[model samples]
Each structure stands twice: as C-alpha cells, then as structure tokens.
Target: MRRSVLGLLALLASTALQAATSVRYCDYPVYPPVSWSDGKQPRGLAPTVVRELFGRLGYRVEMVVLGNWQRCLLDAAEGRVDVVLAYTSAQREQTLRFSKVPVLREEVAVFANRQHPLAFNRLEDLARYRGGLLFGESYGPAFDQFVAQHQNIEWVSSSGQNFGKLIRGRIDFVIQERRTGQLFVEHLPGAGDIVALPPALSVDYLRVAVSRRSPLSAHMAEIDAQLQQMADAGELERWLQESEVTYRDMVRQP
Candidate 1:
C-alpha cells in the first residue's frame, strides 16, 4: 500500500513537470546587434528586449539558433519552433500567426556604391537597373511583389554576398534594411564603395511570429498586450536605449 501511494505521488510529480509551460523560438545567427549570440550568449537588441518581456511573463523560453534565414522560416512554418523573431510578410501571413504588437520598425531600402548613382525614387524606377536581393528573403509587399513581376532582379544566397557583388560592380544596386546594411558594412571585408539610398522603400512593423500548433499560442495574445502596454508607456524605447548604452560600454572596454 505504501508502494502504491509513492508510485501515485511520483506519477503526479511527473505530470506536473509535463504541464510546465515552455516556448521554443528560432532565429538566424547572422543578424548582429539584433539577435546574434556574441560568443558568450544570445546578446543583442532584440534578444535582450525579448528575454526581458518573456521572462517577466513566467514562460520558459529556449532559443534555437538556426543555420540561416531560410531554415528559421522553415522551422517556424513546420511548427517545430514555437516562435520566431520578426514579422510576417503577406506571403507568410497565410502560414504563420503574428503578434499584434510590433517589436521593431524595419526599413527596407536600396543601396548602391557611392561611386555610382542608382536612381531609385520608387519601386518602378528600378526596372532599368539589374538588382541583387537576399535569397529567400522578402522586402515586404512592394519590393517582393515587384520582384515577382520583374524577373530581371538576381537572387543571391546572402546579404553579405549581395553587398559584396554591389561593391564589385556586379550588380547595379541591392535592397536591404538600413540597420542590417550598417552591420553588413561594418563586417564586410575590404569595403570599397557602398551607400544607402536616401529614399526608403517601405517601413514595415516587425513582430514576433507564433506557430499555430504550439501550446504557447494561447498566451501569445497576452504577451502582445503586455508589449503594447510597454510601448505605450515608452518602456520599450527605454529598454532599447539602455541596451545601446550597455553595448557601447562593453565595446569600449576590453
């Protein structure tokens, strides 16, 4: 009888452990100052903010740093990863669920070597020039939709490669995010001529994408609400500012 009682208690404990809430997230390792690991741990602007928000919500979060942008999207699409960083474009909206609160504002723009001027007042203006774009990545509706219509744009495997090609004069222009372009420039070896276009294509809101099959779906709305509240109270900006200061301090030190 004692054995039976002990067995039941053990079973209850196991069940409780199984019932503990967990969220699995995925993101590419390349995007620095946003989601990179920085050799020690996941240290970046997005990771810092996200870690704080989810930690406060009492959710056990685990991050899966994937191979590249494409794999991250696939993991989220296949429901293997419970959540992913960044927003869903119109094409991906059909497959994934997005949080209502935006985490960051993404500005996609055209970049060219400063030595050469690539006229880009609007999307239609790019018809004349050969362009390079990140493989398996989208520039929201306007640019992606435009690419679908115009087959002349070359699709490259990585943003670094695209920028490199632009510097080599292999492509007339490349469209990418301003922040991402800055990071790429900082890391790109032997940077020659590269400058961002004065005009931006579109400023899209970036949000956390949730997997529909994950048990965490039920709580995503709550998380989104908390994020919105933080944004309204200027807490998100404050966190970002603090993160920047921390990054600068760390960079300045040994």
Candidate 2:
C-alpha cells in the first residue's frame, strides 16, 4: 500500500509538469526599434515588452523568428504559433486576439535619396514618382489603398535592399516607420545619402496578439488584465524607452 501511494504521487507530479503552458512567440527578421531578428536571435522593443509581460504571467516563452512578416502572421493565424507581435488591423482581428492595450504607436514616413530629394504634402503627390515597399506590409488603410491602385511601386524583401536601390537611383522613395527608417539610414553603408521627409504618412498602433488556437486563449482576460496593469503603471513606456536606448547603442557599436 505504501509503494502504491508513492507511485501515484509521482504520476500526479509528472502530469502537472506536462500541463504547464508554453508559448511559441513568432517574430519577423526586421522591423527595428520595434522588433527584429539578428539571424539567430530575436531582439528589439516588441520582444522586450513581450518578455516582461509574459514572463510575469508565468508562461514559458520560446521565441521563433519567421522569415518575414507574412510568414509570422500566417503562423499565428494557423495556430502554429501561440502569438505574434504585430500592428493591429481590422483584417488581422479575424485571426488573432490582440491585447487590450497597444505596445506602441507606429509612425510611417517617406524616405528619399538626398541626391534626388522629394517631399509630399499629400498622398496624391506620391503618385508623381516610383516607390519601393516591403513585400507584405501595410502603412494603413489609406496608404494601402493608394499603393494597390498605383502601378509604379516596387517590392523588396528587406529595408536594406530598398535603401540600396534608392541610393542607386532605382526607386524614387521608400516608405517606412520614422524611427525604423532613421535607424536603417544611420547604419546602412551609404548612410549620409538617405533622408526621411517631414510629417508622417500614417500612424498605427502595434500590439501583442494571441493565436486563437493557443491554449492561452482561455486566459485572454487575465493576459489583457496584466497588460492593462502595466500600461497603468507606466511600465510599458519605461520598456519602450529602455529599448530605444539599447537599440541606439547596438547601432553605434563597431
């Protein structure tokens, strides 16, 4: 009877360990000042915020870097991953459950080569020149509709490639978030030749989204409660500031 009781206790402990929730958080290769992968590892603002939020929630997180933004979204949508850090959109709401509070406000801006400087006071002004864009990114509803209607836009896989093309006079301008564009321009080889235009093209909120198929789906209320608490306590802003400083130091490294 003593031996049987000991064996039953061991079985219960094993089952408890197996039931612990583990989340696979997917991120794309590049976004910077927001989120990016260093080829082998993930880094940047979003990742930092996620680490704090989920770490405190007691969930085991495994960071996975998908090839691109589209892949990251796809993985999250299909429930292959537990979550994805992304910009919130009406379309995305159909696939993932977004956090109640946003992690950051993303401001998209136009970038042009210094030699062929360009500026636009309105969206219509952009129609005058050819532009380069990432393969599967949306600036916002208005800009996205504009890009779809226009035919001169070129698509590239990476910001580095877009900047390279812009420097070679292959494209008239490239659109990206203000801070991200600045970071790329400051670090890319022909740094001095690229510049971001004044005023922003669009501003959107970015948030953490949990996959519908994740086991954590049942705990959405609790997850959002923690996020709201962090926001209320100003912890989210502090994380963003810390991330900005860290990214600046990384870019300045030799």
Candidate 3:
C-alpha cells in the first residue's frame, strides 16, 4: 500500500508540472483605452486582449504595472517579465521578439493648447517649439530619429503630466496617441483646452513582445496564430470599443 501511494504521488507531481504555465507581461499605467492601471494592476484594452490571447493558449497572465514606461522596459530587458504589449520601436527589437501581425494600430498626434494654435504642417514646423513626451516612448523609427536629431522634446512621467504642462504653458506641444488624448480631453480637468493637430505624426502598430530570454519566446508563432484569429474574428475592434466606453465612464463625472 505504501509503495502504491508513493508512485501515485510522483505521477500527480509530474502531471502538475506539465500543466499550463503562467505568463507575465508589463503594462504602462495611465495610457487609457489602450493600457492603464486601476491603481492595483493593469487595465484597459491592451490587458483585456492579453488576457484573452493567453487564455486561448491556456496560459494564466500576470500583469506588472511598475513605475513608468522606462521602468517597464528595464524590467523587460532584465527578464523580469515575459512580454510587453506596446508600440514597436527599433530599440525594442533588439531585446524582444515580436509577432509579424500587429495587435493594434495607434495614431500619434501633436496636441497643442487651444489658446495657442500651432501652424504645424509637418515635423519640421515644430523645430522651434518644445514638446512633452512620455518617458521611454518612441513615435516610430523615422519620427524618433527626427526628434533625436532636430526636435526639442522633454521627457516626463505620464501623458497626463504632459497635458498639464501644455495647459500651463510649460511645453509648446504634447505628443500623444489620438484616442487616449481624446479621453483625457473629455475626462480630465483642464484637458478641455487641448486639441490634436491635424495630419497625424505617425500611424503605429502595437505588438506584443516576448522577452528573448524567456522560455515562452519559443511560442511566438503560436501567439501570432491566435492574434490573427482574434483579428479575423473582429475581437480586437470590439474590445477597443468596449474598453474605451468603459474607461470613459470610469473617469467621467456623474
């Protein structure tokens, strides 16, 4: 009887070890409608889609909403998390593996205080002005290079802070995602004075990046397959719609 019990215990332990694994990812707080934190963990469309995708693959998700975007990337580089659901940049490609199919499309825009209309026709038009950008953010490779070489941009902690600085005349413009900026305009105090300048700066694709050092890096193909299916089924769009409405309600005044 004792021998039989020992064999059964070993079998159960092996089965448990072979069960579905848990995958952890990073999330930037205050990036509403796409990524945000409820002060406890990451919330918004990005986390929603992450949970759905990982759930489909039978993996439990753990969301890490640390300090800021810079902090999140640092953790990713150190292999502290398994994935980062964010916009792709040249620097990120070096340390992480990305799926060819994008997870979401984001429009980058320059927001100016309505009281101070900007005569911005292109990236060059803003050379004289100072802009606020969230820390560790990249609009894309081309614009990022332009900013690096020509533009005067100040890095800050959150998009909300950028908007605040813009209203206070501390910065000339705020570079932010169009949708999230709209949310801030509608939900945040004094944000009503902001307007997104026409002619988007860049149309970016948000993709899930798995850390190269992570064991799950081997599952990129599988992850992409599921992402494609989710896109085909219109799940991503539906989730965006739902997430935006939910977020607005959360921040909107009664």
Candidate 4:
C-alpha cells in the first residue's frame, strides 16, 4: 500500500507539471487602449485579449511591465521573459518567433494641432514639416526608413508628450496609432487641440511573440492553433471591442 501511494503521488505530480505552463509576458508601460501597466497591474485591450488567449491554452500568465518599449524588446530577446506583445518587424524576427495569427491591426496616422494643421497625400509630402513619434515605436518598414532619413522627426517617451508638443506648435505633426492617439487625446489635458490628419501612414498587424531562446518555443504550433480558434470564432474582435468600451468607461469615471 505504501509503494502504491508513492507511485500515485508521482503520477499526480507529473500531470500537474504538464498542465501548469507558466508564461512570463512583458509589455511597455504605456500604450493606452492597447496595452499598458497601471502601477504593477496589466490593463488595456491587449492584456485583456492576451489573458483570455492564455486562459484557453491552460497556461498561467505573469505580466512583467517594463519602463519602455526598448526594454521590453531586450528582455524578450535575452530570454528574460517568455513572450512580448509586439509588432513584427524584419529586424525583430532575428531573435523572436511571432504568432501565426495577429491579435489586431493597428491604423497608424498623423496628428497635428488644429491651429497649425498640416496635410499630406504621400510620405514625401511630410518631409517639409517637423514630426514627433514615440521612441522605439515603428509604423512600418517604409515609414521607419523615412524617419531614419529625416532629421526633423523627434522621438519622445509617450503620445501625451508628442500631443503636447503638437499643441504648442513645437512640432508640426505627430505620428501614432489612431485609436491610441484618440485615447490619449481624450485623457490628456489640452489634447483637444490636436486632430488626426488625412491619409493613414500605415496599417500594421500586432502579434504576441515568444523569444527564440524560451523553452516555450517548441509550443508555437499549439499557440497558433489557439489564436486561430479565437479568430475563427470572432472572439478576438469581440474582446477588442469590449476592452475598448471598458477602458473608455473606466477613464470617464469620477
């Protein structure tokens, strides 16, 4: 009876270990309406959807909020974190394995002060004016190349700061994700003075990426299957819309 009990205990332990897949997910501190950390807690749309995704996969997530976008990238690349919520880029693919299905498609746009408004039909049209962008954020390959060649574009830490610069006429325009910029405008003081301009810069799909060095790398196929299921069932879209409404309501509260 003692030997039988010990064997059963070992079996149970093995089953528990197989079921408990601990994921260390990291994201930047501020990218409102998408992903952000309120103090130590992860909040916003991406986190909401991510939590649901992993929950379905029978995995436990421990969020690690970094101080900046660069740090998040570095931590994921160095295997300090298991995964990161990030956009796929050619440069990043070297060290990170991206999800087969994207979580969301982000619409990138240009915003300028209402009083000092500027218009652009093409990428080259914006070359005459100064611009602001978040440090380490990428719009797309073309825009990234454009910003790299231009000296007039300045990088700030957050969208709020860029909007402030735009309102003050310190920068002629700022490029950011439309929904994210709108969220910042709704919350930040004096942000009402800034408006999104015509012509979107780019539309990039965002995905959850696991570090190449992570032990979870072998489970990429299973992760993609789960993501595909959510997409097919339309749960991903519903979660995104629900998260946006929830966040808006939270911000409006007294």
Candidate 5:
C-alpha cells in the first residue's frame, strides 16, 4: 500500500513535468507585412518569426489580437501578455524588455503626388510644402518637433485616409513607411499617382519584446541569438515577401 501511494505521487509529478508551457502574444491588428492580426491570430513577418523562435525554445506560443495597438502595449506592460512584437520606444523601455536583434527594419518614407512632387533635399525643405500625417503616429523626437514647429501638416485618423486626402490635393505629401505605403498605393483606388520619394525619411527596427514582469524576459539573449540566425539564413526576408502576398490576397478578398 505504501509503495503504490508513492508511485501514484511520482506519476502525478511526472505528468506535471510533461505539460507544455504556453506563451501569450499580441500585435497590432492593422500593420500589414510586419505584423497584423487577422481578427484571429497574428499574421506577418515578426509574428511568424517570433512564434517559430519561441516554439523551438519549447514554449507553446499563440499570437492574438487582444485589442488595438495601444491596448497591446498596455497589456504587455501590465503583464496581461507575455510577448509583444513591436518597435521599441524610450517610453516603452521602462516596462518592456527588447531583444538585441531586431526581427526586421522599417523604412519611413515620404509619399507625394507624382503630379506635384516636392523637391525634398533636406528636412527643412518639407516646410515649403503642405503635408498630411497619420494621427497619433510618431516619427522620432526631432522630426516630430520639426513638424510641430515648421511644417504645415494636417492629421488624419488613418494612413489610408491620409493618402485619400492627398489624392484630392488637400495635402501635398504623406509620411509613411515605404513598404506599407506601397501596399496602400497598390490597393487604394485613385492612389495610382502616389509615389514614394527617394531616400527614406528614417530607418527603424521591429523587435520582439517581452514584458519585464514575464518569465520570458530571462530568455532575451536566446531570442536575440535565434533572430540573428534567422537573419543570417535569409528567413526574415522570405517571410516579409510572403507576408506581402498574403496581405494583398487578404485585401482582395470580399
């Protein structure tokens, strides 16, 4: 009787050890190609890479659209979620730990009406033209301050809306990420005349970040190593290309 009780307790402990650990992740629902939730799971480069990386590290990972971008950040900060794949900002650094290796690079570019392009040689040159920017978007501190002080730029609620306003000549230019702007121009009817100006306004990175309060924060170096291997193997670029096609298909679907 004593032996049977000991064996039963050992079996229960073994069963607990065999259980897989699960990780919850969140991302922006509308930022295509890099990461966007499909109203179900996250789809795009960063999400896919992070999922693969963490899964291989023996964690059961699921990326979901918990809410909007702001909500996702809040959740990651407050420990409601274990992981969030996004860009790093000084404000976010207080509560979130970021991987040393970025999952991808994002190029912020200027899109202008081809019929009335602005001769943009330097930052101050933008002051000569009227422009539109997405509401709540940030282009780093210096650029933001310049926009506030020197430029006559209007704000719109959505990136697509900014492009639409540009079409009607309401704004002379639109500031956007280069690839994302390409997708918008391709998908938005009457945006055919929109062209991304050369020499991107700025280059930023997309990284996989974990909440400081989460246990995964201990695996930061391992995550960075995996991301560097992915970069070396060309997996990240392949995923980016695939995401573009996937997103275009999603846009075309009725």
Candidate 6:
C-alpha cells in the first residue's frame, strides 16, 4: 500500500510539472505589424512571436491589447503584466529587465510634405528644421540629444495626429518608424500629402522586457537564451513572415 501511494504521488507531481505556466503579456494595440488586435481578439506579428516562443518554453501566454503606447509601457512598468514585447530604447532599459535577443529592428525616419522634403544623411542636418515628435515616444540617445539641444523641435501627443498636422503644414516634419508611418498613412485620409525619407535616424532593436516586480525575473535569462536560439535559427523572422501573411489574410477576409 505504501509503495502504491508513493507511485501515485509521483505521478501527480509529473502531471503538475506538465501544466503550462501562465504569463500575461501586454502590447500597443494600434501599432500594426508589431501588435494590433481585431477588437475581439489579439492578432499580430509581435504577439504571434511571443506566443510561439513562450509556448515552446512551456508557458500559456495571454495577450492583453492595451489602448496606447504610453499606457502599455506603464502597465509593464507597474508589473500589471508579466512581460511586454517589441520594446526598445535605453530609457526603458533603466526601468525593466530586457531580452538579449532583439526580436526585430525598427528604422526611425522622418516624414515630410512631398513638396518640401527634408533631405539629410545625418540628424544634425535636421537641426535647422522644426521637427515634430510623438510626446511619449523615445527615439534613442542620439535623437534625445538632438531634441534637447534643438529648440526648433516640438513634441506632440499622437503620431497619427502629428502626421495630420504635418500635412496641414503645422509642423515641418514628423519622426516615427518608417514602416509604421507608411502603414498608418495608407489608412489615413491625408496619406497622399506625406512622404517618408530615405535616411533613417536609427535602427532601434525591439526586445521583450520583464517588469522588475514580476515573479519571472529568475527565468528572464532563460527566456533570452531561448530567444537567441530562435534568432540564430532564423525562427524569429520566419515566425514574423508567417504572422504577416496571416494578418493580411485576416484583414482581407470579407
């Protein structure tokens, strides 16, 4: 009877070990290709990659589609979520534990009115122009230095709104992701007026971050290692491509 009871207890322990680890993840829902939900469900390249990587690591991932970029950062900062993916910037690194593997790179570029394009290979060239930047977003150390030293630049609330204001000639040029601005403009009424430039401010690497308050701090290195493995195998890009195709199909469906 004692041996039988021990065997049953061991079986229960094994079963418990097999159960998925629950992880809550948050992301900006408006940013497409990176993260955006269909209102009813979460679906995007960033979320897809997060889901796949964690799933393989034995975690049951749940995606939270937070309203705005700033709020999503806040949620992660407050430890209201276990992890936040596709995050970048040294400013953010000061507050959160970050992934060593960069999920992707975003080219920070300037968009201007087609008639008066802002031409420059370097950031210093734009010092003479009045630049419009999103209020809560950080472009990195160099851009931050430029913004601080240049009185010509002004910060605004929304990237979409900034693009609109730029179209109306309210601001000289707006800074944001090259692909993001393109995707956003494609869906906007004033898309015809905006033009993204050839020169990018920087290629910011996107990474998954864990909150300092999260219980998963011990596993961050493990997560980073797994992500690096995925990167080495080109699994991350392959997953992104697959998710892009899926997102396109989902959007195309009537």
Q: RMSD for each model, in Å, please?
A: 7.2, 6.7, 6.6, 5.8, 6.8, 5.6
- Tens-digit per-residue lDDT, 134-180, candidate 5: 55466677687888897588876566678888888888888888988
Candidate rank order under lDDT: 3, 4, 2, 5, 6, 1
lDDT of 4 by residue, 1-254 (tens): 99999899867644553465777888775777787555558787777767777776667888887767788888889999988878888888989999989988888888888888676888888999999977778776887888778877988877667888888889999888888888778877777778887688888888989899987776676678888998999987887777677677777777
Top candidate on lDDT is 3
lDDT of candidate 6 over 13-73, digit per residue (tens) = 4455335478788866555667656767766678877887778777898877655667777
Q: Is candidate 1 or candidate 6 better by lDDT?
A: 6
Structural similarity to truth (TM-score) of each candidate: 0.81, 0.86, 0.89, 0.88, 0.78, 0.80
Error of 6 at 214 (Å): 1.0
Which residue pairs in candidate 2 collide? none
Better of 2 and 3 by TM-score: 3
Which should have the higher TM-score, number 3 or number 6?
3
Write the candidate numbers in order of decreasing TM-score: 3, 4, 2, 1, 6, 5
Error of 3 at 121 (Å): 1.2
Question: Weakest 10 consecutive residues, lDDT, candidate 1?
Answer: 12-21
Lowest lDDT 10-mer window, candidate 4? 11-20
How accurate locally is residue 136 in candidate 1, as Cα lDDT from 0 to 100? Answer: 65
User: How far is 1's C-alpha from truth in model 2 (Å)?
Assistant: 41
Candidate 2: which stretches are off by over 4 Å? 1-20
Per residue, candidate 1 scores C-alpha lDDT tens digits across 97-209 of: 88888887878778888777777899899988889875567777777778888876887656777888888888889877787676657546656568888898888877878
Instruction: Evaluate all candidate structures by whole-model CA lDDT and list the values in order.
Output: 0.73, 0.80, 0.83, 0.80, 0.79, 0.75
Clashing pairs in 1: none
Encode model 3's per-residue lDDT on 69-177: one tens digit a residue.
8888878877899888777777998888888889789898989998877788888888888899888888878778878887599888987788888988899898888
